[model samples]
Every structure is written in C-alpha cells, then in structure tokens.
Target: MSWYVYILKCSDNTYYTGVTKDLKRRVDEHNGDDKKAAKYTKSRRPVRLFWSEPHESRSSACQREAAIKRMKRTEKVALASRV
Candidate 1:
C-alpha cells in the first residue's frame, strides 16, 4: 500500500504533519467531525493541504513526517512553496 507524508495548514494558520495510507480519507476526517481525527486538528477545523510526498512504506512516511515536524515554520513554508 502506498503511504503519504502530508502537511496541513490548519484554519488557525498552523501546520500539522502526519502519515497516512489514504490521504483523501485522512484529510476528510480532519475536516469532518470524526473522532478519529487528530486532537490537534479537531480544534483547528477546515485545514488545507499545504504539501505532500509519497512514500513506498509507512516507515518512510512516518520518518518524513517526523522530519517535517522538526522543521521550523519558515522551512516548512519553503517546502510547501517548492511543491
């Protein structure tokens, strides 16, 4: 199964990084009232897709997510702009 490392720009203008197998479903959950959604995103509704990268494995996707999470705001913005 394909995995994805995604960056979401929350309604609050903050970024949330995560790894998911179904990007569409995950994004929908974030925007919807699903309890499965991340707690951090639950309050910051209406998040927008800022950036994403495909990965062959969940491990890689998770690793990338961690790396992106460690990135400074400016670096993350640069990454979003690049794609």
Candidate 2:
C-alpha cells in the first residue's frame, strides 16, 4: 500500500505535517471533531490540504514528514507551492 507525507494549511494559516496510510481518512479526521485528529490540528479546525507526497513505505513517509516538520515556514510553503 502507498504511504503519504502530507502538509495541511490550518485555519490559523499555520502548517501541520503528518504521515498516513490513508490520506483521505486522515484529512477528514483533521477537519472533523474526532478523537483521531491531532491535538495541534483539533483547535485549528477546517484545515485544507496544502501538499502531499506519496511514498513506497511507512518508514519513508515518516522520514519525509520529519524533514518537512524541521523546515522553516517559508521553506515549507515553497515546497508546498511546488507540489
């Protein structure tokens, strides 16, 4: 199965990075008032997908998520724009 590394643009204009095997479900969780949503995203509801990259494995998706998390906002925005 394909894994995914994704960036979400939150209502507060901040970005969130995460990895998931099911992108659609994960995005829905972030936008919905569900227990599955990340705490960081829960308060910043109504997030929209800013960018996503597919990976062959969960490990790779996690690695990319980490890398993106470490990037500056400008850098992340640039990366998102390219997607």
Candidate-wise lDDT, in order: 0.92, 0.92
In TM-score terms, candidate 2 sits at 0.95
How far out, in Å, is residue 13 in model 2?
A: 0.2
lDDT of 2 by residue, 1-83 (tens): 99999999999999999999888999999998578899999999899988999999998888898988999999998997885
Quote the positional error of residue 34 for candidate 2 in Å.
2.3
Tell how far residue 32 is off in model 1, in angstroms: 0.9
What C-alpha lDDT does candidate 2 achieve relative to the native structure? 0.92
- What is the lDDT, from 0 to 100, of the residue 31 in candidate 1? 94
Residue-level lDDT of model 1, residues 1-83, one tens digit each, is 89999999999999999999998999999999668889999999999888899999989888899999999999999988886
| Residue 25 alpha-carbon offset, candidate 1, angstroms | 0.5
Task: Give the true-structure RMSD of model 2.
Answer: 0.9
